[model samples]
Target: MGLLVKGKWYDKWDYNNDEGEFIREESQFRNWITKDGSAGPTGEAGFKAEPGRYHLYVSLACPWASRALIMRSLKGLEDMISISVVNTLMGENGWTFEEEEGVIQDPVIHADYLYQIYTHVEPEYSGRVTVPVLYDLKQNKIVNNESADIMRMLNSAFDEVGANDKDFLPENKMTEIDEINEKVYGTINNGVYKAGFATTQEVYEKEVTTLFDALDDIEERLEHSRYLVGDEITEADWRLFTTLIRFDSAYHGHFKCNIKRIVDYKNLWRYTRELYNEPGVKETVNFDHIKKHYYRSHKQINPNGIVPKGPELDFSLDK
Candidate 1:
């Protein structure tokens, strides 16, 4: 709902352009964490993979942040890295660490809002204060704010430091995984937001149509295969799972993505259940936070801020 510019906070929500298309800002922090403390792909080196050296700040209400959370769970990095979660309702202040039912106070810097973390890292930091933020506790700087990079780091960077050896981006499936991830990231992962936040009817129609098309394609793919990449669960599955889990609860009604609920899709619904039933995954989901954040935060979309009480989502393992 807001952004930081030259270390200054603004209560602005002008993400749409002249055409009313929601243009998501690119993540600014691009540093990396490697096992040898060397550089991985982008940004600087020296962020060696170590135990209890980094901290993660995430919002359970956020899909991007949830991606990192799922990776952390799958890779078993809970003890190595500490974490703090923000409150569900993001208002004018935009993602504050306020006291609430699920709020986890920021122990590193004791900041009231997420923006303070940005200012603490770089006094003149100019960008959206986003999560999940990978903070280097030793250097007292933000390691990375980009979710995709954070997932990759969590997948393998801490493997030497007692992290699980399971490779989501296995060598044999790397190419297919990358290809599927690219498609899903643009159309399905971000497509719901593009549809939800679109200010014009024309833009909304275009985006919503593309989103369902991608979902339809995915449903067909899952009809014969157990997962997105088939047989095994990759990072692609986890990445898409965050959005799918939130679809019926938040996106379907709140975002006007009502053409077809995920429950209507036989294959997709089954696939979602499979992923949700995965070890250490269901606990990461917070439906209260998910519903409240979207329904209350976006006053422009949902002016009343009245959260709905019934979608009747009962995600459980089938006996």
Candidate 2:
């Protein structure tokens, strides 16, 4: 992992805090793209939705980035908003589009590295360069880099341009969806990273325990409810889906989140396959990219960088 220091690249991976907990950096580009070029819930305005006017830079290996890709596919926005997937392995250069299998080189800005795109938006930008970035072609600026916000944008922002009307964030379940998102985001989504990147054993134990506790809670909830919010698949379910899909393959081993594999949870494993089988969902998942990235990228964790090949997954769901 690396970050840009005032438009300059720096190879670094010090994400731990004084307490040895891995703290995720807040996304710097918070601007939004609304349907009518109006200001969104939390950003400047004038980023109106338009076909072939926006692009996405993402990494299939990243759960956060995968959320945006899933939404784009689910909402039928593939042709509306274009995407360029970076290489799976994040090395010293940090999220490059260099020639590699399953990698789609950046065709918009033609940048070799993702940080170059960030610096192009703000020459002196200072922050961690992350994926799922929404860029405006008309305005020639970064609309938003936060996955949650981008998901909402793709849900409704381009409806006039022939995008799907399936509302992932419905009005009635807003409160419940937000509440579930909070818990899942804290525990399951970010929890694995916190555990894997923890500098001390105490922090790792605390995070891993909290992570499994959250998973157990969700497993119990899924036993009764078809989805996280209810019968309808909401933003909450998709948000959790990205992390769950990668749990057994990467987190369980590479992240040392081996308390149990996601397959060990009866309801969750079934639920995962159900979602995976959902139309347009499976296409977004690339296990080769996911495994290679986590295992090979983090040299501090696995210095030898040997990718594992066991723990075969069965993504089949019973009717």
Candidate 3:
């Protein structure tokens, strides 16, 4: 992992001495593409919804990036907006375009590294170059890098252009969906990182316990409801589902979030399987890419970089 300091690349992991916590910095771009071509919370108005106007840069391994990819496929925006997959193993230069197995090369600019795209957008851009970047093909700039915002755009913005059938974030369920998203994002989604990257044992124990506590709560909540907010599959369910799908497979062992495997939680496990079986959802997941990225990339976590082959998950076979 690397970050840009005054537009210069520096290969270093995140650190926070004051709090003794692995604090994740918020994404810089937070724009949206509405139907009316209006400006979002940030950025300009030229990023209007148009066919072949946008291209998404993502990694199949990343849950955050996977969220956008899922939305794109479900919304039927595949033809409207193109995509590029970065190599899963984020190395000294962070996300790169080194073609290896399933890692898709940068087709838009043919850049050697993903950070090159950031520098292309803004020479002085200073932040972590994260995935799920919505690039404006017409303007040749990053529309938004925030996955949450990109999900919203993919959910609604391109209705007139195409994919007008599916509405992941229905208006009636907005409030409930938002509430679910908040809980999942904080506790379960980012909780794995909180537990894994904890500098102290005390911090790790606190986060791991909190992570499972939230999982238990969700497992209980999912007992009656088919989805997080209601019987209908909404944005909230998709958001939480991504993390749950990755829980036992990656987070449990690699991230040291080993309180209990997600498979042990009956409701969560079934719910995860249900989501994974959804139309176009399963295609977004690339387990080989996901597993290799985590095990090999984080040398500190897995010093030998020898990827594991067991645990025998059957997510690929139909539920």
Poorest stretch of ten by lDDT in candidate 3: 13-22
- Shift of residue 56 alpha carbon in model 1, Å: 0.6
TM-score of 1: 0.99
User: What RMSD, rounded to one decimal, does every model reach?
Assistant: 0.9, 1.0, 1.4
Residue 120 deviation, candidate 1, in Å? 0.3
Candidate 3's displacement at residue 57, Å, is 0.5
- Cα deviation at 319, candidate 1, in Å, is 7.8
What's the TM-score of every candidate structure? 0.99, 0.98, 0.96
The parts of candidate 1 lying over 4 Å away from their true place are none
lDDT of 2 at 195: 93
Candidate numbers sorted by lDDT from highest down: 1, 2, 3
Better of 2 and 3 by TM-score: 2
Please give, for residues 143-221, the per-residue lDDT of candidate 2 as tens digits: 9999999998889999887998899999999999999999999999999999999989999999999999999999999
Residue 252 in model 3: shift from native, Å? 0.8
Supply the global lDDT for candidate 2.
Answer: 0.92
Of candidate 2, the 10-residue stretch with the lowest lDDT total is 310-319
Steric clashes per prediction: 0, 0, 0
